[model samples]
Target: MKSIRIDRNRRLRDDPGTGHNRWHPDIEPLIEVAPGEEVLLETRDAADGQVKPHMTFADLAKNDKKVGHPLTGPVFVKGAEPGDILEVEFVDMTPQPYGWTVIRPGVGFLREVFDAEFLAHWHVDGKFARSPQIPGVRIPEGIFMGTAGVAPSHEQMRSWNARETELVSRGGLALLPDPQDAIPASQPIASEGLRTMPPRENGGNADIKQLTRGSKLQLPVSVSGALFSTGDAHYAQGDSECCITAIEMGATAVVRFNLLKGEAVRRKTRFPRFSHPGYFAAPEWAAPHNFVATTGFPIREDGTQECEDLTLAARNAVLEMIALLGERGFSREQAYVICSLAVDLRISNVVDLPNVCVSALLPEAIFER
Candidate 1:
């Protein structure tokens, strides 16, 4: 099996040749392999080791946001080309000992309300992740990569930039291309590379927990050789990742690649599709036997309602869960992190116009009482 290893004690910046922090077609592949070849890749944490177990919120201010989601490899898969489908089979994942969840300012779904910075340091074992900061709570292991994707073609990159730039001009929340702290920090690649925050046609940062071991993710290929990279492993995460983080950690992921010639074009696939043969999480957690749920609607706090707004409904659902946790003696920050790590948001009803209902379900089994 082919592999790429990195020094865990050092940041990705210290050895930029092994990985990259941005997505650009021109960034050369770290290695090339034939189709159906299996590869093992060791990856850095999402924050590139800037957030440590001993660190507090004070350290967050000094973090370099540009270095977020430092991916391990743009492994070139031979025979994969534009209009083909690249199937990534996640064979296994080995989680590191330490993991963390954070609530940073100007990030997450509830960024406006939970503006304060908070951190939860976890001791991750084989089966569960227990946090010293969150007393009496234990999150079950559901290891998976948080970000994985292929290099976008030059035309795709330019088109994406243009659309995002237009969104920014209209007061949308989009991170534009910035070369500062960028890996492979050379020439136009640094200035034009796409950020790793959102999922696009190339499938970066989908954060789907269901893509665990035995799962296969099919991505629409847009570039030759399908230069694929992956990183930002998570020990566990809620569906919404409401607080914008899970049990974030560095991990070694074992994956194999397969190609479906002309399948993407034949199916008109524009987004990633994934499937898992078995349960993605612990049996009890996957379909929780005991749970508490909160329901929310599009109606705002001021008695006004938006027209079929699922986003507002989800926000309200999570806020309600936070309030419920507060009644159980958890601080707002603690509750937010808990929601991020354990809560599952489901749309109960979307056909109900002007009042789409969303439910936030908290599995009671996670509490170690």
Candidate 2:
């Protein structure tokens, strides 16, 4: 098996359509690899290595477009045939000695209320940071690449948020079936093309907090040569990722690839498990919630079942406020948007019952505070 290291040497000038600036990886085209081969990638942080010790918010404001989440690669996996799964096991991500997390104006869950941009800088004494908010809170700092995925399967597929303005010109397949499964089989399926901001079946910007260390992401191979890329390395982010940015910092990631051919797996599963033997302190603010799982059965063009018991399970915890608010006073649409801004989505159990159980947790404070 051959191993390659990928990096992003330049910044992307194109608009990511999310009103944020994005950077593409500056690396050679990916070299194809046989099954079981691995690629170790050295990923950059969201700033594209621009943040400095003496930098101020003025520096950030000047380059606001270039400061948001950035990603690397369009690495083409060799011999990776369609109908296969590309497994990315994150071996390690080492953060720089310093990092920054900022909340920008008109961005984040509290965007309308808190319109001013706030910056929180930190110095990593060890693998952690002393919380700049409160004295006792210890911040476990680790690098997590925010944006990572392959290119679309077809030409017409624009970035996720660009659908309304751009016509579906050429071939483009929606990874997620709409209310109905009306996607075409012959069309190219780029999992990244489905969701507007991360968190798709192909695992684009799944800002899951649990993806910190020792997590494995398994993405389906839609087109040949699973084009894999990763960037937007964050140091620490809350569950909801309510803020537009996390502790944005530079990162070096080692990725190992494994091919799962003809394996029976659910559409969504908790990222591969990591075992930490040492005991760790749980944040006082953290609370547990029940798990709710839903299965999406593939429907034929005629609305009949194509395969029996073949279901995709999505696990998410509904916030009591959002659920109760919708049930009582607020409209479902309003409640859903509130939940999207406040609720946290996570994978609970991949091997449970007939379907996998994904967890979505809601912080009680969002409602109380």
Predicted model with the maximum TM-score = 1
The lDDT of each candidate is 0.91, 0.49
Clashing residue pairs found in predicted model 1 = none
lDDT of 2 by residue, 84-169 (tens): 66776676677766666666676655465445555556667775654343232345554566766654444224444365324334
- Estimate, for each residue in 1-369, the C-alpha lDDT of model 1 and write its tens digit: 899899988898898888999999999998898888899999999999888878887888888878988999899999999999999999999999998998888889998897777889999766899988899998988889999999999999999999999999999988889999988899898899998888898999989988888889999999989999999999988899999999999999999999999999999998899988787354666667699999999888899969889999999999999999999999999999999999999999989787889999999989989
- Candidate 2, residue 72: how far the Cα is off, in Å: 2.7
TM-score of each: 0.97, 0.58
Which candidate ranks first by lDDT, i.e. highest? 1
Model 1, clash count?
0
| Candidate 1: residue 133 lDDT (0-100) | 87
Candidate 1 structure, TM-score to reference: 0.97
